[model samples]
Target chain A: MDIYDILFWVLSAIAVSCALGVILSRNPVNSVMFLILTFFAISGHYILMNAQFLAIVNVIVYAGAIMVLFLFVIMLMNLNADVEPQKGQLVQLAGVISGGVLFLVVLAGIKSARPVTIDKAASDIGLITNLGKVLFTKYVLPFEISSVLFLSAMIGAIVIGKKEDAKPIAPRDEEL
Target chain B: MPVNSTHYLFLSLLLFSIGIMGALMRRNAIIIFMCIELMLNAVNLLLVAFSKIYGDADAQLFVFFIMVVAAAEVAVGLAIIVMMYRKVHSVDINILNRLKH
Candidate 1:
């Protein structure tokens, strides 16, 4: 195998193993840590694909910020491995069937994909430069919409995270 | 033949399947959240591989959007998980079957 092949195998193994660890870890904090590792490995794969900006952003946004928030929640709640509900055989069977369908569909998709020759030497970046153009110019509406979504999510999270009060005031526009 | 785009496709498929397995089988809410992240990463891999194959940056850009969405999802999801924990004291999803209200 060539260098590319070896790197692919190694990176993918790290990604898959960390992903498994995310699911298998009993503690939520540890699971989030594993999830961060999974994101880091995937970032490495993006670097391998020559998307350096994407790799950096992936690490910063995912492994750095989002997962830190997750850890904060886990710790704030004081979740421990003990006192968690146990799994049942039915859950495993459901998992098996669901995973089986996902596997089948993906395998069929791979079989059906038409062969396409990839060009690796395209402009070293469409990352920060051209991607900004696409996001702002071509997909401007969607970008704005995403901002709105995030704003709403920020509000919703604030609302949810607030300490419970005696009564929450309903909006004026609600039914009188 | 040596491995190529097809192999990447298979790898992504397997990862997606594994994510599905985790989502379906795991009783913990945190584990389900992680599985969803894995599925998103699997899609990102497929997107990057296709971007390489097609000589396009659009897929890479989409990957950026996916990362953004995944971040938002985890933020909101964890917040809700915290809410659940406040009421129930456990994040294990298996015991959460009182949804008939």
Candidate 2:
């Protein structure tokens, strides 16, 4: 119909297709790239929803930071399509069946629900100033706690990922 | 001409389902992790849409919190994956059978 409607359709198509690419692409690297594309499309959807702040943050945190971390680990491991093991046929079938069932159920549920329309354009809730005010004032405790969680996560990642200086014992030697 | 909340809901549902399939079917640990991130993004999209509908900022704020937790989770989760790769020489989840005993 109009620009809003057209944008929504286009972005949703991009997101869903890219999501499929994430799963079906044999190369893990390509899969990561597809995931990043999906994030970008979802961020476009955020912009359409008038959440400008969230749209930016989604791009920054997801496509920018998290995906780069993924890429780093992927490259660090030197993963390739040849090395990725395939699941059994039956397992793959089951996964597809389950996912399809979920989609059908959720789709049916959504079809039955009444659509809520916004009579007016959305307010400034998505702006950085308003979001920051709420984050620091009303939600300050959780915000502070999340920082602590990040700290612990950083420490945990460093500890888990740190290379031990001790000469790595051979697996066979340890078994013996 | 205007997009309704239901439109966003359907989009989120599609993305989430794709994510579930990816997580279930993929053998690579990192790709599975990426699927989880995809699911989180789907939820973020839904939250922003709902916030727009309700004319409120809380849901958007919650999205922020979700993003924070997701980042931390990814950091620790990826580190764990790297550790597993070191031990097993592969990122295939099927190979991670040492804990079965």
Candidate 3:
């Protein structure tokens, strides 16, 4: 066993455990924190893959920006208290079944992946800037459309979350 | 002691399924967002692993775009969660089924 082996095991273990914690933790704040740890661990894996740009961006976007937003919303919502664990027995059973099926499908796919030949031309240039070039020259249309979609989604979110009249969104039957 | 890519893939599959379970079963909207992040991270890991094994950089670049989208998602999703909390006083998602009509 070499350093690479040890590093792989340790980081993979941390990522998997923290991801599980994100799902299992009852406190939303705790769950968000676990998610942060998971992101950090994943960034480490990216580093191992020799993708330094992706590593930094992964940490910055997912860990620094997105997770902080999650923390703020969780704190703002006051979900830090001892809210009863959601008794999602029926939904959970169904989730487990589906999750199992999906995992099997993915595992089978992974088992069959062929190592295709790499193009020497692609690796001759550094990807950080090359990707930008591609995005502008080749992928620009999809890029522009996604940004528009994001803008519309942002508008929809603002509209959906706007301050309301007397009624809570939760109907009476499901209200706890 | 070098672990193969299959090891990482199986682990990723487990993490992805866990994320799915959280998204499906969690009543707290915040946790659901985190689970989605988990799933994205799993996919990102797979992309990078494939990028390494194939010696390609395009997937890594694609991951960069994905990170941007995920961040945008969080900004919007957090805003919505805060709004929902203000209106409902709790983030219990089961309470959100009222919109199903």
By lDDT, the best candidate is 2
Off by over 4 Å in 1: A115-117, A120-122, A166-176
- Better candidate by lDDT, 1 or 2: 2
> What clash pairs does model 1 have?
none
TM-score of chain A of 1: 0.84
- Top candidate on DockQ is 2
Worst 10 residues of 1 chain B by lDDT: B92-101
Q: Where does candidate 3 stray beyond 4 Å?
A: A88-91, A112-127, A144-176
Which lDDT tens digits does candidate 3 get at residues A1-176?
Answer: 66666777899899988988888877777887888899888888877767777888888777887778777776766668867566658878888788888888877887886544322222432346766786688778878877887798678777776667555566658655
Judged by lDDT against the true structure, how good is candidate 3? 0.76
Candidate 2, residue B15: how far the Cα is off, in Å? 0.6
TM-score to true structure, per model? 0.88, 0.93, 0.82
By DockQ, the candidates rank as 2, 1, 3
Docking class of 3: medium
